[model samples]
Each structure stands twice: as structure tokens, then as C-alpha cells.
Target: MLFDLTDLRLFIHIAESGSLTRAAERMHLSLGAASNRVKELESRFGMRLLYRENKGVQLSPAGEALLIHAQQFMQQLERMKSDMQQFSSGIKGHIRIFANTTAVTEFMPQVLGSFLARHPQVNVALEERLNADIVRGVAEGTADIGIAAGPVQGQGLEIINFSTDRLVLVTPREHALAGSGRIAFADTLAYAHVGLHEGSSLWHFLSRIVSQSGQRLELRIRVRSFEAMCLMIEADVGIGILPQSAALRHSQTMGLALVELDDPWAVRERSIVVQSLDALPHYARELVEEIRAGQAPRAISPDRNA
Candidate 1:
């Protein structure tokens, strides 16, 4: 009770930055004011919390103990606010979702529009991230929900199967491998590829596969959208791997051939991931239901491993 939220926050900043000057700047307080606050905290507790050094400050045993409690308190405060948001019409509820490229580019727009229309007071932040990053974000409570594809270990989390899709190789109509019918992903690495931008989840997935195969992708160009990649392929820039849904849609207008990938990993089961559905606020839960409602019809794959 001796230190207020502002004092605790300032202490956290100083502990993290290891500099009172930097902490003062972060807390928007003068150096003297920040020093007095720390002094008062120590005076109330009758213990030295930090050891001052020429360069910066180091936490004493007491300071470390306080830091742990302070961090937990801040996290609980955030959770409390989120839980209380649905009851307050004046406050806007916020949801953060991390998803794979396929979900972000192919499915989310339509579902999100409907969800936003229903919840006008709610805000959504959707970001594309790799499977690992998405899982980590959800686990760490950084993301309210995660949309991931393929097999996932549900350690301390809930996984809901939402849809299914396949990754297929796209090539120009006249390309040499266009008539192959189906090809292994490793074989495709022999040809030049039109890949997604490095930051895209699909790009990260493909790069990991290539690394595991001990081969490298001969990337001719990088694009941000499936349409762009298809256009590039039509222009004979290079071949590419794309979600079958996207490739099929583009093949109608572009000179692109969709060839099935002979790899088990190509057949992906898109899933909704969260720490716990019941723990989410009403608005966040509603968004999850919206995504589930937009599920694609399940596709049968020949590969048992799919």
C-alpha cells in the first residue's frame, strides 16, 4: 500500500532498463521525482531494493521479489479489464488474432466483416504469423486467438478444427512441369520459384521445408498476394506453392496450372487455437464462432498422413 501503481510501474521500467534516467523518461517523470519515489518505497519497506552502479542499477533480493509480484499484478489487471469490457458499452472490446497466411489471405476477410458488423463496438487486430509464432503468442496470452494449419501439439491449449485445405504447386501452362500431374515438394525446389514475401507465414513454412530437405529455393521474385504470385507465374517468372483454393480461383483467369503436391504436409487442417474458449470475453468468443461458421467443406486426401 505504500507504493502506488505509478510507483510500481516506474520501478518496473527502471528494473527492466537498468537506468533511473531511462525509467524517468519512460514514466514521464523528472530524475529527482523518480529518485524520491524510489527512496520513499525503500523507506516504507526499510530495505534497500536496488544497488546503484556507475553504469546502471541492479536489483537487490528485495527488488527481485517485488518485480515478480509487480509483473503478476500487471498481468492480472489486464485480464480483469478484458473480462469487464463486454459489460461496458462505452468501452471498445479488443481481440488480437494471429493466423497463418492461408487464413489471413483466403478466409478471414469475409468472416471478419460479418463479425465486425455484428459487434460494432469491438476492435480486431489480425496478424499473419508462422505456426510456431502463433502457438507461442496464444500460449503467452499475447494473442487472444490463433489460426494455424497442419498438426499442432495442444499442450495446455485447446485446438478446434475449423477447415481443411491443400497446398498445390502452380506453374505456367507451358512450363515443363505443368503436365507432371503431381510432384513432390522437394522436386519443385529444382525449378525457380515465385515465393511469398519473407514475412509471410507461408514463406516461413516453405523455407523450413526446404531447409529440412537440404535444398534451397531458387526464388525469382517475391510477392505479397496469391493473385500477384499467380500473375508472375502466368508471366513465366517462376513456379510457386499456394493454397489450392487460391490457386483454383486464379487459374480460371490466369494461365496457371494447379498440380497436387505429393507431400503429406501439403494437406493442412486449419484449426482455431486458444488457451481456453470459456476464458475469452463474449466479443472474442463471438468472433471465434464466426470463423467456425465460415468453415470450408472438408476435403478427402489420398495421403493417410494428411
Candidate 2:
């Protein structure tokens, strides 16, 4: 049976609003026209989709199924349109990448800037995601590439060592911990902490570790980006744990002191993940080569507190 996208969208609106009249108003259609469209959908499906109620409407069993598929269909279509818009704008290629927060905030800007400078026809869509989500997105073809730290496990994915980053604790120059050159993550929990906002990849990662450490992270406040967290720390709001590179970079302008974390997990070995290198488009393969060429061992300068 064939169902139109417009009708499917209307049905979704009706399902969400629980009122056909409201759905009609939202879709800019008359109530009668909306009712007829729903009726037409029911006729095409050969089954009752929604159960009319005095209050509004409820989805029948068949309606629930249709709603699930309709939402998926609409989402896929929207993604297609977004990808196609790049071409319409004279972009020759599009690449989607999902990576961990550190890579997103610390590493990708220079890499992407250089790559885009060399390939003006290419466009990239990058999202910061947790390591597990990055692996899954690459494996499911939701993203063309993924950059995440190690302990990554996924079938049919080619993993290449991308870079290494260390997590360090940053504090104001006069904070109690600022006198120490190295401290364990658990020890930092004793003081008020500045952290990335909840639902951020770093937030989730730190939460998991705190759970494992059998201690709670005493978060005084949460900010959106690493630089914001650093600013908060510099203001003596709270101590923060961030990638070493970021801490060192911010220390140049801010009076923040960096203290190395004793925990082994503090050091992360990031990797570039792809379903298949050879299977990627020519432009994608070139970008991959660019990323690979950019990989090099970085030497950490002495911590400020040291």
C-alpha cells in the first residue's frame, strides 16, 4: 500500500497532539480535510489506524506500527535532504564524523581547517558523541568516520591509532590541590568541581569512572565547553579535569595550574574508526589519509604545578 509523506506527517502530528483538529491547524489544513486524509490512509492500509475518542484520538495497534515506520521514514528523508543540500550548494562531497568530546574540542579544529582549506568542494558534519556511540555510528553507517579513544570494540570496523591525550586536573593557582604535581582522580572529588554539562560525552565518561571509584564527583557547576570549564576553574569556582592539551593551552592565558592525574585511565589512545577504508568514496579516502598523515606523538610540557 502507498502512503503519501504529507499524510504520514499529518498522522504523526495527530498522534502527538492527540487531536485531529489541532493537527489540522498545525498542518494548515481544514479539520474536514485532515479527517479525510486520515480516512484515506486507513483505507489504503485496509485497517483502522486511530481510534476516535471524545477527548481526542488514540492509535490502534495498526496505527502504532504505522507511526513507528512513519517516524523512521520521515527521519531518513530529512537526512537525505540535508545531504542533498550540500550538493545543491556546489559542494562536491559530504562526510559525517562522530567523535568523543576531547577530539571534538581539542583536536578536530586544526585538522578540519587544514583539510577543508585543501578541499574546498568537501563538506563535513561533525558531532561529539561518546566512544561507544562513535563506534556504533560508524558500524551502522550513520557516520562515515569516527574518532574515539581506545577500548573500542565493533565488528567490521578498521581502527587506526589517531593520537594520545592525557586527562589532567586543573585548578586556580591558590587552590589546595594546586600545590601538588600529581593527584588521583578520587582525591579531586573532595573539592567542588567544574565539569561539562550532563549528557556530554565527557560528563558521562567521568560519571562512569566516579561510579567505579565508589565516590561521587562533587560538581559545583556544569558548563558546555572545556574552555568554559577552564574559565570557571580559573575563577576559583571549582577544580576541573580536562584533556592535558586543553589544560596546557588554556594555562597560557589563564592563571590555571595543571596537576597530572595518577589514574591510568587518564591517558587515552584515540583511534580513527571506519567500516572499510577501500570501500569509502575517493574524497572520504583522501580525508582519511589526511587524518592519518596528521597523527604524530605529542610531547607534554611540564605541568604548571610541577
Candidate 3:
């Protein structure tokens, strides 16, 4: 016999209330109709679904299984309804957004929060990934939108200027290089460096820079975050590089010193990447436009394709 959603829902209601009378009131069905529905389900299954006792009714093994399936069915229906409503009034939507560490930790939060405030029915699931990974995600349709740091390494993607940040060298205030106003990244590599874990994009990016310069970075240790790296630097562990804002703020509190890097690549220009803006759904495009709106004129990504 074919079972319908109403059968499952009524079964769940009865299973929870343990009384047909109460379940009927909740479903607005008469007690007789509720009882008959349960009997029909039990007869079709060829087994008793509920065991009636003095205290209340309890699920038989078969009813327990049905309840599990019913809950899952209800959840799927909710998702279907939510997705369906987007077309008519944009009452609900889900967007897949990917970004690098800097964008995710610093800027994306505020931008997403503001967007969510304006569109309560829309939901976003964001992931922090390396720029390379983000590029791949956008191209392969794994992510609807991507925010990546400088020198994003793929073509065929529609790119827009997202934001700008600089990587500044941080050192102990009394360290020998502390007084240096501006230095090259290659020069900073001469000192033992405290950095993020090996897997982090910043670490990998720095490693690539040192490799390209034909010099070896003296990486002494790896920590988790900019603040943690700052703490290690405060202990005189080693020098490090961080975003300008993060470096300056932490240096003020921790007595660390910041130096501007002379390398042309030290200043990072981030971009928002998508396989094709025109291919995005209406709600996804809304999200993309909001992100574009938040950026200043200089930060607005240039048409990389142009």
C-alpha cells in the first residue's frame, strides 16, 4: 500500500501525544477519524503500531520506525517549501559563499550580517578556504560566490575588486629591525619567523614568495592566528607578517613594532570571483550586488575579464 505525507504526520502526532483524542484536537480531526487513520495504518502494515496500556499508548517496534521516517519526511518538506518560496517573493533562499581567511575573519562577517538583517528569509553557508581552493570552488559550482586575497590564480572567472589589505612585518619593539621604516620581504626572511600553521594560505603564500626570491625563510615556529602569532612575537620568539590592521592594532597593545614591506606584492588587492554573475539565481545575485555595494569606489573590483 502507498503511504502519503498525511498518514506519516498523523502517525507522528499520535505517537507523541500517546492519545488519539489529543492528537485529533491538534490535527483538528475528530477522535474517530484519528483512531480510524491509525487502524488503517496498522492494518496495512499487518502489525500493531501502538500498544495501549493504562498509562498511555506506546509505539510498537514498527511505529518507532515509522516515526523516524516521518520526522525525516517533515524536514525534507520544510526544505522544499523554503526553496519553492524563493521564486515568488524571495521569502527564502540559501547561498553558498567561499572566502579566504582574511576575508572570512575580517570583512565578510560584517557584510553578511548586514545582508541577513535586510533579508531575513535568506541564509548563507560560508566556508574559509585558500584563494586557489576558492577559485576552484567557484568554477566547479561548489560555491555560488567567492572572496579571495591577492593574485587569485585562475582564469575564466568573472572577478570584481573586493577589498585591499597589506601584509606588514611585525617585530618586538626592542628588536634590532624594529626601527626599520620600510624593508623588503626578502630582507625580513633573513630573521627567524613565527607564522601560522603550515596549511594556512598566508604561510603558503610567504613560502612561495621566499622560494621565488631564491631565499629560504627561517621559519622557527607555527601558531594558529594573528593574535597568537603576536603573543609569540611578544615573547621574542621571532618576527612575522600580518595584515596591516591586525599588525598595527596588536602592536599597540603588545608593544610590538610594525614595518612596511617594500615588496610590490606586500599590498594585497582582493577580488570577488564567480563563474558567471549572469548565471547566478536571483537571490544569489542579490547577495552579490549587496557585497559590491559595500565596497568603496577604489575597492570595487575592476572587471578582470576586461
Candidate 4:
């Protein structure tokens, strides 16, 4: 049998508060009105939903069953309302984004800050993962969008060029190479380097540069995160290569210095990956557009030196 939503709300409130008077106060209704509403609902269903006990109200067997269904129904209704508001307003839904550590720490703050300020109603959640994992999250629908450096190869996903970041060499302030504003590919390879673990996007990018230059880099240590690599460099364990933004952001606190990599291949493009551009929820699409447009002014020139 169909039940009125208002009656269900009153029943749930009474069940939650364990007192009819408390529920009436919460609902801004007189106690008599609340009692009459409950009585009418019970009469229609021909079953008592609550039993008065010494301490509080208790739900009967049928009340328990109806309560479960009512809660589920209310949750579904709330979800529907949220979805509809997002569709109509272009800004009122949860967007789950997966990004690499570099993007998460360096780039996303400005983009997200602006998006949130403009939308106000949108809620955003960010997950940090490696580049590959970010791509996987977007493909699997676990994340609404993925942002990272370099291209992601997968079917059924649209990759958009968002921005570009140069990979630079970082060294401790005391290192001989610290004063060099820009170092050639051969010079960087000559130093012992701290690098991301093999198979990471940064590692793969560095490998390509080494291969194209006909040399192999001497890696002193392999670590999982940019922060770890920076810590190692600061301790003078080894020099390292990382995104320029990461180097600049941590340079002061980490006691590290950054030098531009003169290698032509050191530049990398940051891209936004989505499962389907057209299929994204309204809020997600809006976020993607903001990121894309926000990078227009910072678009890397084809001339690497520029």
C-alpha cells in the first residue's frame, strides 16, 4: 500500500527522537497534531508503528520493516534531487578527481579554488595516485576525471591537452651543479640521480630522454614520491629531476635548488582524461572546461626555449 511521504517523515522522526513531544518540537508541529498524524497513519495501515515503553518509543515488527523501506526511499529521493539540481545549475554535484602527486600538490589548488568559488554549490573530492592509477580510476568510473603529465592510452576516453610542465634538475644548495640555471642533457646524466621508481610516468619520461640522447642516467636511488626524492636530494644523497613546479614549491623548505633541463625532451604536456566528454555529469564537465580554459594563458610554446 502507498504511504504518504509526510507520514513517513513523522514516523521516522518519532522513531529517531523516541518521544512524540520531542518529534513534534523538532518538526515545528503541536504535540496534538503530531499524535493525530501518527494515529491516522496507523489507522490506514491497521498496525501500530510504535509501542510506548518506560524509557522511550519502540518500533513493532511492521514498523521496523516500513522504517527500512522509508529510509531507502528518502535516500533515493535526495540523490535524485541532487542530480536534478546539478543538471539545472551546472554546479551542484560531487566530482571525484584523480591526479598524480605533482598535479595534486602543484597545479590543482588554483583550478579548484576558482571552480569552487564560482560554483559554490559543487562539492569536489580529490584522490592522489600515480599517472597510470589516475587513468585507471577514470576508466573504471571510480573517479570522474584524471589529470597528469603525458598521454594516457586507453579506449573510450577523451584526452584533452590542458597544460605543460618542464622537468628540471634539483640539487642541494651545496652541490656544484646548484648554481647552473640550465644544464645540458649530458651534464644531468653525469650526476648520480634520485628518481621515481621504474614504470612511473616520470621515470618513463626520463628514460626516453636518456635513450634519445644515447646515454643512460646513473640512478643512485629510486623512491615512490616527489617529496621523498626531494628529501634525498636535500640530504645530498643524489641529484634528481622532477616537474619544475614541484621543485619551485619545495625549494625553500627543502633547501634544494632547481635548474632547467636543457634537454629538448624534458618538456611534458599535462592532460585531462575523461571516460566520455559527452557522458560526464554536468558538474564534472564544468570543472573540466574550467581547467582547460584556465591553462590557455599558460599554454606551452612549441619553441622549448620560450
Candidate 2 TM-score, true structure as reference: 0.82
Q: Write the per-residue lDDT of candidate 2 for residues 88-184, one digit (tens) a residue.
A: 9998888999988887888689889988998899999999898888998898777999998757888878998867778888999888888886798
RMSD of 2: 3.2
lDDT for each residue of candidate 3 in 1-306, tens digit (9 for 90 to 100): 547777788888888888877888888888888788889888888899899788778999988998987887787687567667765676557888888766676667888888889878887888888788899888866678998878776679899886677888888878888877788888876799999987677878888888887888888899978889999998999999987766755665786877778888988887889988898888788878877777542211112101
Rank order (by TM-score, best first) = 2, 1, 3, 4
Candidate 2 CA-lDDT value: 0.87
Compared with the true structure, all predictions reach lDDT values of: 0.87, 0.87, 0.79, 0.79
- The count of backbone overlaps in candidate 3 is 2
RMSD of each: 5.1, 3.2, 11.6, 12.0
What tens digits encode model 1's per-residue C-alpha lDDT throughout 1-306? 888999889999999999999999999999999999999999999999999999999999999999987887787687678657754756478888999998998889988988889888777789999898899889878789999998877699999998787898888988888877689998988899999999888888888898988888899999989999999999999999999878877887787777788999998888999999999998898888889887775332333111
Q: How close is candidate 1 to the true structure, as a TM-score?
A: 0.77
- At residue 14, candidate 4 shows an lDDT of 83
Under the 3 Å rule for N, CA and C atoms, how many clashes does model 2 have?
0
Better of 1 and 3 by lDDT: 1
TM-score of each model, in listed order: 0.77, 0.82, 0.64, 0.56
Q: After superposition, how far is residue 169 of candidate 1 from its true place, in Å?
A: 0.3
